[model samples]
Target: MKIKIVENEQQLQDAYTVRCEVFVEEQGVPEELEIDDLENEAIHFAGYDDEKPVAASRMRLVDGYGKMERICILKDYRGKSYGKELLLFMEQVAKEKGIDKSKLNAQTQAEAFYQKLGYTTISGEFMDAGIPHITMTKNL
Candidate 1:
């Protein structure tokens, strides 16, 4: 297994492919919401198991803060701690980019996951893409 930040167009596409499969196809997120606003400017990462992508995520600078978004792991890869690894990598990336704080709007089901990473809830549960979500943040 190899986990590293994606630095090329091919890796970026692979990450987006994983997100599309999990978020758009499996989770029923709209294609429009799944693909919007992501571009070359966003920082992307991928986790490969035997050279095949099994998980991925991306972060973008928002108003001088790093916002982790589109975190997805293939269904077969869940419950194996890959998501935690990816989130840790994102935190390191945020620090490298000179940001000391990070934020994400996490799905309600994932609130506990982020909480375990030391993120605090900042808002009441709300709907995003028809699913429950909450704002979370942590200092790097």
Candidate 2:
């Protein structure tokens, strides 16, 4: 899979399409909440397999940490390591920006997946978009 930095309108829309599929339609996240106001401030990413969007995520510098947001892979594309690949690409992007740490509020169901990549749970479970999540962080 190739990772794309969303630098244009079409690419951004592609990212949104992936997010809407996995987070909104499939997981029941409200469309309004999934695509929030922070969209303009973050660096968006879209993972493609021969031009088909499979995964998407974004990262922003928040309080000196690279905050990962909206990470998701399409249902048909899950369990093939594309999520891990997308995350590692985001981490690399953070490193390039001189960030030394990364943070994310991962859905509880995906907590162990992030753990395998070295994120440590830093908060008790909480709800976001009506789904259970826990804050996790990693030192880059």
Candidate 3:
């Protein structure tokens, strides 16, 4: 598997497709909510397995820190560590931009996944798009 910073329209669209499949079609998140106005402002990353886009994530600088968002991996790619790899790529990008901290709102069920990556829960569980979520952060 290979991951790279999305650098063109097609790559961006690939990232969107992954998110739509994971968040909208599979998880029941509204399509409108899944694609937000922040797309143009964020740095997107796409992961591929032998030329097939299978994972994606986005990051943006927010208040001197990096905010990682919309991390998704296609169902077929979930157990292969693509999600973790995409996340590490985002963190590397953030650090390159001088961001020493990163934050994300993780789905409740995935909290432990983030924890294993050194992120700590920073907020109480709350509803986001009708799903339980909590804020998490890690110092890069």
Candidate 4:
């Protein structure tokens, strides 16, 4: 698997496709909520299996810290470390931009996954798009 920074419309669309499969189709997140206004301002990453896009993540600077969002991997591609690779790549991007901290709202079911990546929950459970979520943060 290889990860690339989305640099063009095609790349962005590929990232969106993977996200749609994971978030909208698999998890039932509303389409309107899954695609948001931040795409234009955020840095997006797409992870590929050969030439097929299989995972994606997005990050943006928010109040001097890196805010990561919309991380997803195709169901067929899960359990292969693609999610962790995409996450670490995002953190490296943040660190390169002088961001020492990163934050994300992790689904409650996936909180342990983020914790394994060195993030700690900072907020109580809350509803996001009808799914339980908790804010998590990590220092880069």
Q: What are the lDDT figures for the candidates, one per model?
A: 0.89, 0.94, 0.92, 0.94
The clash numbers for all candidates, in the given order, read 0, 0, 0, 0
Please, what are the lDDT tens digits per residue for candidate 3 over residues 1-140?
Answer: 79989999999998899999999999999999999999889999888898898898899899887999999999987888778888888999999999999999999999999999999999999999999999999999
Cα lDDT of model 3 overall?
0.92
Candidate 1: clashing pairs of residues: none
Worst 10 residues of 2 by lDDT: 46-55
Error of 1 at 30 (Å): 1.1
TM for every model, in the order presented, reads 0.94, 0.98, 0.98, 0.98
**Candidate 2: lDDT of 67?**
99
Name the regions of candidate 4 deviating beyond 4 angstroms.
Answer: none
- Tens digits of per-residue lDDT, candidate 4, 44-116, equal 9999999999999899999987999999999888999999999999999999999999999999999999999
- Between prediction 1 and prediction 2, the one with superior lDDT is 2
lDDT of 2 at 128: 92
Model 3 CA deviation exceeding 4 Å by range: none
The best-first sequence of candidates by lDDT reads 2, 4, 3, 1
lDDT of 2 by residue, 1-140 (tens): 89999999988999999999988999999999999999999999999989898889999999999999999999888989998999999999999999999999999999999999999999999999899999999999
Screening candidate 3 with a backbone cut-off below 3 angstroms (N, C-alpha, C), the clashing residue pairs are: none
**Candidate 3 least-lDDT 10 residues:** 76-85
Q: Of the pair 2 and 3, which is ahead by TM-score? A: 2
